[model samples]
Target: MASAPQAQGLPLFYNDLQPLSSDLHANYKIRRAETAPFLAKQHAVPLTVEEFPLVQRYLPIVFSMGDEPVPLGLMGLNEGINVFFDADGKFRENEPFYIPAYIRRYPYMLARLRPDAEELSLCFDPTSDSIGDFEEGEALFEDGKPSELVQQVLKFNEDFEIAGQKTNAFMKELKELGLLMDGEVSIQPDGAAQPYIYRGFQMIDENKLNEMRGDQLRKIVQNGMLPLIYAHLFSLNLMREIFGRQMQQGAVAQQEQPAA
Candidate 1:
């Protein structure tokens, strides 16, 4: 893990997002064990799978552990921890796709890790209309090949290194957490990649319906239980504004009724 950057002039929200517990190491180990196999099978390779509950999974952990108001520098790190799917299984970088900037940062990290002349100068053209714009290109099912994008991700992980002390510290933490998995999990560049599909969670229209249903259900049981549970505390603040306006209108109506 990199040293947390300086906190000068940063918002209080950034500091409020520290790790909920030191149990992240164990969580990550279990997640990796489970996801690796699923991804491998999806890609038609031999791999392991670990059963992970969606709510108790990666994004939640990252959100709980992330420093907030998140530094722009670290915003992408969380996105990288999760997997993505494309309906068409093909992506070009310049297009306004949903992939976050932080997710795109992996190629940069890979270039730093490998440092080969051809690889280093690969110029990840974030602005290009070419298919190369996205590191993971479309999965080629006919040839059983992963998209270029997946290749880039693997290349980066292959080359990442930490400072000696930091590496030791992370290792110690891993050992203490009992996650001393020895072998490196590699997704070969030429391996068949999994078909990309749209994640239902990312589907906005359906999600809106689900959210509304949850809101209504919670309101019935506890007035606004769902809002509080979902961390939409601002909704209460908005209600206060509406209440104030209603009160002002009532005051005007009372005055007019007396005058008439």
Candidate 2:
């Protein structure tokens, strides 16, 4: 989803967006994805704050770098690497991995039709193999109306949009409080001359949080922002685990190279 852009300025995993209309796509059928090959090489997946508790157990929750930083769940530490998913984007055997909702909502999203559009329309990627005029799969429409599956998909997307709002609010608070700082993680393997240092991300500054005045700290804690921040901090411990996974999967080479 992160590599090889198909459409200019499009969201991850989307090549082209078309409104889901019964008139236009009445014959379309939605095929569930058995393997999301697009995600095979993606190292980071966007995450909503609502998923912090569950996702922290599987992926390191860190904020992305740049002006508009968003939460990202690290499937691997470096670019073009994923530990839990195979090359075909299927979960590894016997491994209980938590799939982010962002990945699950791929090929379908709510987008504004025009620059000044007030409401978002339900849209799907035309290039995706998951939805189209297929002989098999669930029907998207029934008798010129949206089917049950369509209803469910819309509901899920709506919930995702709400979660995105909450995540944005959480990020705004963090930024306003100056609690985020450039993130770095270093891993030193046995007998290695130099440690592999991973950088180019943002993270919560614990010192800043600890040094905050009582009123400021109480505000975040009362607003339920503290737990998500702690969840992100706790999840940082998984960086070592992910590095070890990359080693086991042969994703990291023996030669010392900086990870960006």
Candidate 3:
């Protein structure tokens, strides 16, 4: 998953915001997100439907463990175990984890100007250290107008919102087609007596997907959903990899713990 725009609640570190004004934000700037403590979770993060292919290579594409079934890119096999990120809540130097667009678009998001307003306004998380006056990074405004960097962020947010809408529509199709089902994965550690059983998530049921009639299948194919489904299927194989990494991480942690 290359995004998390549809999470049930607000993303981590984004408490609330005040409107970004040229007058009020003349000196605000944001550093590169790569090293920022932007994400603290090792759990699966939201992913737009379109991002499945890109992230499927190294991450498992699964739905949220909750009833509301949203697509997620698994950074770890279980909660509190994002193997890709290091202890400092940062991606390992040169590790090349595919950073989600959700994380990249931090501190800035589109929101309604008012409760009943039909229009959206660009807003910023004023509390973010990534924002605020900084002489070293790209500025939000210049000469009381939005700077080029601000314009770029606005465009990215706009496109992300559009993609989010498409993702919602895709999810609706999945629900209507009865393609979603409970997820499970079983793994046996070497020399272990029992296999670890994993569940509590939603996934595409291959059986049901294959049972669709010719017309229904054709409809989805024409809608360009077949590849996305295949990407998901292929990505599921990475679940075992995530589990193995978790085990490795466990061992590393144990070794690093100081003696009592």
Across 1-260, the per-residue lDDT of candidate 3 in tens digits comes to 22233454556558777788998888878776545554555467777887888889978888764445678888876656677777667775475567777767778888887779987889888777778888878888889999888899899999989988988888888888889887888877897656777776778999999899999899899998889988999999998888888797772122223466
lDDT of each: 0.24, 0.88, 0.77
- As for lDDT, the candidate ahead, 1 or 2, is 2
Determine which window of 10 residues in candidate 2 has minimal summed lDDT.
1-10
The CA lDDT at 214 in model 1 is 55
Counted clashes in each candidate structure: 12, 0, 2
TM-score list, all predictions: 0.19, 0.94, 0.89
Candidates sorted on lDDT, descending: 2, 3, 1
Q: Where in model 2 is the C-alpha error above 4 Å?
A: 1-8, 253-260
Q: How high is the lDDT of residue 48 in model 2?
A: 94
Candidate 2 at residue 44, lDDT?
Answer: 89
Q: Judged by lDDT, which candidate is best? A: 2
Give the lDDT of residue 152 in candidate 1.
Answer: 58
After TM-score superposition, the amount by which residue 3's alpha carbon in candidate 3 deviates from its true location, in angstroms, is 14
Q: So what's the TM-score on candidate 2? A: 0.94
